[model samples]
Target chain A: MADPMKIRATASGDVCEIKVLMSHPMETGQRKESDGKIVPAHFIQTFTIAVNGKTVIDAGTGTSVSRNPVFGFKVKGPKAGDKVTVSWVDNLGDKRTDEATVA
Target chain B: MDATRRTLLRGMGSTGLLAAAIAAGVLKPTRVFAAEYNKVAFEAKDLAGGLKGIGAASPAESKDIVLSAPEIAENGAVVSVTVASKIPGTSALAVFVEKNPMPLSAHFQFLNGALPEARLNVKMSQTSLIKAVALANGKAYMAQKEVKVTMGGCGG
Candidate 1:
């Protein structure tokens, strides 16, 4: 299982800023190991963020993203204490979902 | 090792459930994986090809899309970038590094009430033009910025 995603949500005025730090290898399949074998591509393919059960962000990522990526974005209208969930699906069909509350 | 084992078991269980659902016609696999990763887009060698791979052609340069990045990066291995689109009804945003072996770095789709803004770190081979494309009302808008890298990131 992938590591649990760390999420932080803070509200400033009427907008809430959400930051996500995901633990992933994000291997590009181009690197060679000590024995010279190419690493297979394993990276997150899709990421979605929801606020109060309403879908807000859906993204497709590739191996070009660095390992353990940190994504930050702002959403309008989310107030303090609103539920925020973030999830991701990798190329290998692996999935992880974690949630936080707007503070 | 323990985490991997647990994840493997969980993955198997979900796959079995999905298979049963598909067999019973209760779920469409395609719909479940609606946003399939575009290999061609990620492997495109040039900006035009990259855009075409993502189904965008002749994107107009616009100011509504904001791309924020350091003018000079001390390390190319981890260059931070942020993109924000002010266009109403914006649906998607993508980033492409002009000089990288593969230009397209990341692509994001915005759903209901999700703002068109994202921050991510990408690898750059050297100095390059980073382009951000925004899809709004079925039109493609773009913004670009150049970043100088002191060290190459792509295995330099």
Candidate 2:
């Protein structure tokens, strides 16, 4: 269990800069707890980015990402003031969606 | 002068209690607080300046900002790291893993107007200390964390 993810970015050329820190354990289902039960793997598997409703980038993930994962990315041809929506779905049937205006 | 005398007595009472406690060892030991900022500790040649342009310099950094990676890499490999800073006028962030043959793993320059905080993940070549240096307000600061690799890359 984690708090809401935070995001911020800076544009660079055709890139619409983006940074995201989401709240989750991102457990790899590898380690056993004190009771000797293996923790179930739960992680962000898909991330999609769309600018003003036009898709720009998409990605996949794995257990390798950090706990309470943070992601940095860029979108091609996006400008400041443009609306960018970021959404992700983890294997646990949980989903998150957020929007931020470029600046 | 009665009120003044009472106040003085109370002050003295507290001071004496404090003194007694210290002499009896009830007070916790005082610690010298150290300021920590993300810094690098590997060889990056000119990567430190690039990181400076990105606003990640230690308030203690004295040279090239580094992101340490193993010399030969065990798994090919991916490594862990920590970065601290000691500079001033810093407003952005970047990370470099020096063993990958390309020093740079990620770069972060802040938002239009926002607080300065940068964190990231990188693939490393071998085992080395990951460093981060940040510059803020014309001053530099640095911090580092040691990452020991156990699998899949960075040369076992």
Candidate 3:
């Protein structure tokens, strides 16, 4: 199982700013271990953001992203009380989902 | 060591059983949380190949598409990037690091009321041109920035 993500959503003037921080190794496969063995690629491959049950952002990322990735996005029409959900799935099939209230 | 081997064998046994269940239709696999990852685009090795894989082989350069990145990065392992598209009807955005073994870094699809902007951190193998592409109204617009990396990110 993967660690839970940290999510923050804030609304101002009908627009919401959402930020996500995910935990993962984000191995690039080209990297070698201390023993000279190649590290297998392991990274978050897909993620999604939703506001009040409506999908807002769908994303696909490769191994070029840094470990423990952080992402930010903006959306319109979200209010202070709306639910903002963020989910991510990794190359190993591990996944985590977390949510925050628009503040 | 023998105990550890036994545990590993047990884990493998369970995995084989799980696969059998999936194949037998008893445990249907589900990918409800995420859409399919773009393997072809993410695996492209060069800028031109990445652009072609992402279906933006000849994107028009546009000032409205903003790609914000540091001019010099002390750590190539973590370079902050932000891309914003002011073009109307923009629906998707992608970032590419021209020198990485696989240049395509990320792709974002916006729907409903989502804005055409995104911020993330990426790895750069070395000094490279970073390109941001925005798909709008069935066309592609792009912006680029050169970031000098003090250290390479892809090697261990």
TM-score, one value per model: 0.84, 0.43, 0.88
lDDT of 3 by residue, A1-103 (tens): 6688889998999789999999899999899999999998878888999998888999999999999999999999999999998988776556778999999
- For model 1, how does the per-residue alpha-carbon lDDT over B35-119 read when each residue is reduced to its tens digit? 5567678778788888998877789999999999999999887899999998888889999988887789999887766678999
The DockQ scores of all candidates, in the order shown, are: 0.54, 0.03, 0.57
Question: Which model scores highest in DockQ?
Answer: 3
User: CA shift at B57, candidate 2, in angstroms?
Assistant: 40
- The candidates score, on chain A by TM-score, as follows 0.98, 0.85, 0.96
Candidate lDDT scores, in order, read: 0.83, 0.49, 0.87
DockQ of 3: 0.57
Better of 1 and 3 by TM-score: 3
What value of lDDT does candidate 3 attain over all alpha carbons? 0.87
Q: Whole-model lDDT, candidate 1?
A: 0.83
Share of native interface contacts recovered by each model? 0.57, 0.05, 0.78
Angstrom error at residue B84, model 3: 0.1
DockQ of 1: 0.54
lDDT minimum window of 10 residues, candidate 2 chain B: B28-37
Instruction: Write the number of the candidate with greater DockQ, choosing between 1 and 3.
Output: 3
Which candidate comes out best when scored by lDDT? 3
lDDT of 2 by residue, B30-51 (tens): 2100111111222133455435
